[model samples]
Target: MSILNSFLIKTSSVKKICISFFASQFTLLIMMLYTFPIINSQIGTRAFDLQNLGYSLSTANQIVNNLNNQTTELYLFPQLTLLDVFYPFLLALFLSSLLFRLGKLIGKDNKITSLLLYLPLLAMAFDYFENICIILMISKSIEISKSFVLLSSTFTVLKSLLTTFSWIVILIYTIKWVRLKIMKKATKSSLSQS
Candidate 1:
C-alpha cells in the first residue's frame, strides 16, 4: 500500500513521469515477446537468422525485391520486410526513453533512467552480434550446429519482446506526465507548505 501511495501521490521531487515510462517500456518488451510470433509469422525461419542484422534484414530485402521483376533467385525469405520501418538503433533509443518514464512514475527515477541511457549501447552491441550470426548463416560459412528453426525462433521472439517493451515504457511515462501536469496547481501549493 505504501508503495502504491508513492506511485500515485505525485509528491516526489524527482522526474516521476520519465521514470514511469522506462518501467512500462521494459514490461512492454516482455509482452511483445509473447505476441510477435502471432503477428509476423511470415518471416518464419528467416526472422531468426535475420534478427542480428537490425532493420537491414528487412530493408535489404525490399531493395532486392524492387530491383528484380519477380523472384530474383535469392531465397532468403521476404517477410523481413516486416521490420523495414523499425530501425533497431532508433527504435532502441525511443523505447529506452519510454521505459525510463515508466520507471519514474513508480518512483524509480535513477536506476530506470540509467538503464534507459545504457540500453542503446547494449542494443548496438547485441545488434552487431546478431549481424555476425546473419552473415555466417547467409554464406553457409558456418554451421548453426543447433536446431536452426527453434534457435532462430527463440532469438526472434526475445528481440521482438525487447522492442515492444520500449514502446510500453514510453506510454507509461506519458501517462505519469499528464497526471502530474493536471495536478500542478495543487502540487505547487503543497510544496509551498513544506
Candidate 2:
C-alpha cells in the first residue's frame, strides 16, 4: 500500500496523466478499429475480451471453437499478448493519476482517496488475468475446463465493474473540481472589482 501510494504520488503529474490518457485512448482506438475488427471478422463474432457482462462456459467453448474453426487464434493471441497487455497498464496509470489530481483539487488527499486510487489498478489486474484465462482457453480449446471458463468470466465481470466505478468516481470529482474552480474565479473577480 505504501508503495502504491508513493508510486501514485510520483506519477500523478498533469503531464503524465494526459500522456497516459492519450496513449490509452490510442491503444483502444487501434484495438477497436483494427485488431478487434480483424479478429471478429475471422471468428464471425465478438471476442471474449469484449464480453463485459461475462460469458458462460458453453459460450466460452463456442467462441474458442469458432476461433479454432477459423484458425484465427494466431491473430487474437498477438493482440492479447501485445496491445491488450499494454493497454490495461496505460489505463490504470491514467485513471490513478487523474483521481489523485482530483483528490488533491478537492482537498481530500487522505487515506480514503489514496485507497480509491487502487480501483484502476485492480481493474487492470483483473483484465490481465482475464487475458491469460482467454489465452489458456484458446490454446486448450478442445479440452478447456469449466473452472477456467468460470474464472475467466469472473475476472471479466470484475474488470468491467471496477472500471465503471472508477469512471463514475472520476466524473463526480471532476464536477466538484470544476465547481471549486468557478467559485475561486468568482471570488477573485469580486475582490478585483471592489
Candidate 3:
C-alpha cells in the first residue's frame, strides 16, 4: 500500500496522470478496433459482457455450445488470445490511473481517494485470471475443464464489478473536479477585473 502510495505520489499531477490515461485508452481503442471486432464477429451474440461470461460452467458450456465449430476454434486460437491478453492490462492501467488522478484532483488531500485508486488494479487482476481461464478452456475445446470455466466466469464477474465501481467513482470525482476548476477560474477572472 505504501509503495502504491509512493507511486501515486510520484505521478500526482494532472499532466502525468492524464497522459497515462490517454495512452492506455488509445491503446485500448486500437485493440477494440483491431481485435475485438474479430472476436465479436466470430462469436456473434455470444459476445456478451464479461460479467455474463462468469455466470457458471453450465453457462460457459452453453456459450460454447451456441458457437459453430469454426467460431469455437477461432475463439480458442492462440493468435486471438495473444491479442486478448493485452486488453485487460491496458484497461486496468489506464482507467484505474485515470480514476486515481481524478479523485486526487477533486478530493485533494483525502486519504480515501488515494486508496480508491487500487480498485482498478483489482479489476485488472481478475481480468488476467479470467483471460487465463478462457484461454485454457479454448485451448482444450474438446475436453473442456469445468473448473477452469467456472473460475474464469467468476473472475470475469469480479473484473466487471470492480471496473464498474471504479467508473462510478471516476465519474463522481470528475464532475466535482470540473466544477471546482470552473469556480476557481471564475474567481480569478473577477479578481483581475477588479
Return the top candidate by lDDT: 2
- By TM-score, who's the top model here? 2
Model 2 misplaced stretches (Cα beyond 4 Å): 69-71
Look at candidate 3 and tell me the lDDT of residue 14. 70
TM for every model, in the order presented, reads 0.45, 0.91, 0.74
Per-candidate alpha-carbon RMSD to the true structure? 11.7, 1.9, 3.5
Model 2: per-residue Cα lDDT over 36-139, one tens digit each: 88777766777888999998878877877777534555554558888999999999999998998899999988988888999999999999999888877777
State how far residue 87 of model 1 sits from its true place (Å). Answer: 2.8
Better of 2 and 3 by lDDT: 2
C-alpha-based local distance difference test score of model 3 = 0.67
lDDT of 2 at 74: 53
| Backbone clash count for every predicted candidate, in the order shown | 32, 0, 1
Global fold similarity of model 3 (TM-score): 0.74
Worst 10 residues of 1 by lDDT: 71-80
The TM-score, computed over Cα atoms with residue i paired to residue i, of candidate 2 is: 0.91
- Using TM-score as the yardstick, the better of models 1 and 2 is 2
Runs off by more than 4 Å, candidate 3? 11-19, 48-53, 56-58, 65-81, 141-148, 189-194
Across 13-71, the per-residue lDDT of candidate 3 in tens digits comes to 77776676676677667655654566566655444333453566665666666666666
Score candidate 1 by lDDT: 0.45
lDDT of 1 at 177: 76
